[model samples]
Target: MEFHLEHPLSHSSLHNDDADDNTLPLPLFLVEFQHMPSSHYFLTLKSSASLLSNRNFAISSITQYSRKFDDPSLTYLAVNYLDRFLSSEDMPQQQSKHWVLKLISLSCVSLSAKMRKPETSVCDLQVEGEMFDAQTIERMENVVLGALKWRMRSVTPFSFFSFFISLFDLKEEDPSLLKHSLRSQATDLTFNLQHDIKFLEYKPSVIAGAALLFNSSELCPLQFQCFSNRICQCTYVNKEELMECYKAIQERDAIGVEENEGSSETAVNVLDHQFSSCGESEKSITITAASSPKRRKTSTRRC
Candidate 1:
């Protein structure tokens, strides 16, 4: 496997026209993301406390259920579809049932896999425990696709890795190994932290860069500062916001450190679930919700 790590001029300009190819420019979709952010997640849930509390809990279950599937990308895409759909669509006033939400999850994951890994079979993705039939999955996917405007290629933090890595300009022997390693670490961190509502405020590119910064300190201790300095010099990135994001990642990392030092594993999960509720002024995530055709109302909380 070959990976394209070219330095793209702007994330707003790259596109992969060939269907057989899976290449995506980090910028083009990002341009759309400016107007399409997920910050409304918790606030929208606040609007209907009863609906949000119940559905958010179910959403958490769906997130866990998504683990039964093979790829993390599928979960990411499904969540993207879910968020975009809920944020924009007013739920049928009749209220939702658990099965209906499950179908939505199945459809979101199904659609996610198809978009990212086209070769993946829908039947295989259904796996054990998924109750939705092919037609049902297809129907739900249609609703989600329409809500998300068929923009299946979401602008996630992963999208910005190539461009950010290219900025470091590593000159080591087999530099590719170093770059690939850092990207892997950052990608893992991104997935782990994706459930946090706080990350919603930062642009995907900013989050991608911050993840790289966090990993570089661990993956390339000596050269990490240089990478950090280079990113800070980036005109497009906001230094203050990047540091805020970096701090949040660090706070998350601290939970691991605490566990390694003898804290209970159960305690860590509890701490993370209440992470946003911590109410630390600096760690706060605030996004005002408004009417939008494509924004999601949010259906699940990252448990």
Candidate 2:
């Protein structure tokens, strides 16, 4: 999807007219900066256990709600908004108020649907006996827009999938089929890995490259090195960073594999050992989506 700045302005009136009228159009440079990864300040923010747990709950809530719409793009973008909002602003002591959490999830998903032009009804999303009125959701949408600086065009790993896939040299008669399958596999990996906070530390492009490389290792082991070399040689990709992300993904997938085989005890041991050896900065890494609990019911009163 091409992200022309004018497309967003044409579709949604969520940005306040007065505020927008007062400000000049965003410059190309500033717009490009939005696509970059999280800043060091956000990565180093001192988050308490409660804050991380609350964030995990909100992320899981958004994940569950978006799936109801049966749109992968919607789910991806909603979670992207949630993470970016949390990174930009600090939310302290928000765990106790479940309403605020539900509101955040709804607003993010609503905004994502608007941006993607998905056939989603806000009323239909009022799940688990919780109903938020359009006006209340609109208000929260404004909050999210302000926090995100009206930059709804999120640059996720999906953005680089095509570019990386183009680098592959498929010798088969039906390369398009191979490419589609490979892309699909990589896309699912990227989506599932988002729940792991450690993946957030890497840029979208790096994550995209790593995901592609990981998928290629399975689908085309013989050409894995070729794919890796091409990806690493790209000017936008940092070799060391990609390697770190790849390692983290491998470790996360390992735990999933162990758990699926009915070795819950071994999975716990692997998680503990990995966290114990990593530095203080890496301790924020949490469980992958494979072992995450089922999405709890959302219970917000009508707003």
Candidate 3:
């Protein structure tokens, strides 16, 4: 993870003196990372076929359905709901049921749409045309609400974009333009990479770092070393983990190959064995959205 910096940053460069209102301050950003799924959750996603299939279905459904709307945040936020719901100790029984999975996916998009546009109702966001009534969708929404413990606001990688961009020492005259370009490129990667299950192993912060580092190599090859060194020096970053995620993204980008899970055994005892609680309380964080090629347009809303 180490990089040779021809011109090393001074101690002051590592500290954020001015805070951007759109981005979380450093202290709050660190607190938000605590709410991400625990490492055990990733293990369960690997071990259980039912869980993996449900996740795949939910993500795919959300991706397909979310295309009609022009909001990028909806897909990511809906997937976030799906992940948190699946990660909870009390998931709905019959994980293999198609109707139940559709209900879950529908309810998630409905909820995200409501958060972004209060005028939009559950009935309006129904996917694949009226699969379930509004009342049934609302009930499932309640189930999702309970599973997430009423924590609708999510802390995603977007929350860290501005904060991380600030860490770089941009010598360009229009630093804001460079920052916007970097953020846009990184945003594209974060949205597209969500389909890959392996990324679940990394935290949003680590994912953001990897995406930024990956893009920096192309956008500013000359300053890549300096940017990497500054990011490594950040107190909140785990250098090893960042490098691991970075390499994984690089490999995926190089091959342009998307990984798909193979057929597996039944879903027996998966909920009882894998979806149990972590036996500890979790915290919370806020989120926002962005526009990109693979993403829909979105208004500001907590993910």
Candidate 4:
């Protein structure tokens, strides 16, 4: 990757004439970048002492490398680990940004596989990234964990899935499948939108709890009641705001239904011409109460 360096180092920006000032002065390198155009400025300053040549690549690579992991929780872990490692005194000064990023990505996958699927070994991860070797990955994992002080467990996607499940009425077995589908949808949705959906923005723990409650038919009512009580206690969002979101979702669903109906009619017309002699055999689809939509009021328990 080619990097353009237009501005040379200047001493005037570095000197603090105020000798009386007790605070340590800002670095000259930072001041130089501050004067440069936004488009020209790089995130990671290329220090002659450091092994990393391209700082821009370092910042950009982190984002690109993270997508390979595909799991949000794992990506979050990698990001946190990278940030913590960079801030720590023990971080290898000689290591390139590319190496650091690669190491963190490897560590995240290793940790995730261990936690989520214990049966999967380190070799599995190596195979996924054809170019990367297992030994390099293992070494990086140790370094990352040491830098993080081994405090890895934190917010996760499963927790969020569980919380959302609690808000709806679903079976125990239903939740597992629902969680899988929701996670898959969330992955695709995030990629296309590059933003988190409002409905999926709750804390992972809350979401996991909610998912459990939603999945169990026996527990859903109680869970919803508890959620309602908690919402009343919390001042973050009022009842009006909640109702507005619900209304918006309903309108969107209605529009989708109209589109589907038009498509169905078109399909039926195409089939009619193909099988004209058997037209009478085509049964009229009657939507009964079992198939028809039923209006259910959003229940809110008083605090």
Top candidate on lDDT is 3
Looking at model 2, the pairs that clash are none
Scored by Cα lDDT, where does model 1 land?
Answer: 0.60
Best by TM-score: 3
Q: Global CA lDDT of candidate 4, please?
A: 0.38
All models: lDDT?
Answer: 0.60, 0.65, 0.66, 0.38
For model 1, the superposed segments whose C-alpha errors exceed 4 Å read 1-26, 29-37, 45-69, 91-96, 119-130, 171-174, 257-303
Which stretches in model 2 have alpha-carbon errors above 4 Å?
1-37, 40-47, 93-96, 257-303
Q: Total clashes, candidate 1?
A: 11
Candidate structures ordered by TM-score, highest first:
3, 2, 1, 4
Candidate 3 lDDT over 1-303, as tens digits, reads 111110011123333344343343565445554446555666676677677788888777787767777777778878877887777766742356777778888888887776655676665566555568778988989998888777666667776777678888899999888788898999888887776766776777788888998899899887877888877787777776676577667657765554432223212121122222323534111111223342222111111
* Residue-by-residue lDDT tens digits, candidate 4, 1-303: 110111022223343243222221123212322221122111122222242332223434445554554655444444434444554556544546565655565565666545434565666454344456777777777876776566554333332332243333335566557545544554333222111122222232322333333333233444445454443333433343333233323333345643532121111122222222324443322111222132222321222
Question: What is the TM-score of each predicted model, taking all chains together?
Answer: 0.67, 0.71, 0.74, 0.35
In model 2, state the lDDT of residue 222.
Answer: 71
Candidates ranked by lDDT: 3, 2, 1, 4
For model 4, the superposed segments whose C-alpha errors exceed 4 Å read 1-96, 127-135, 164-303
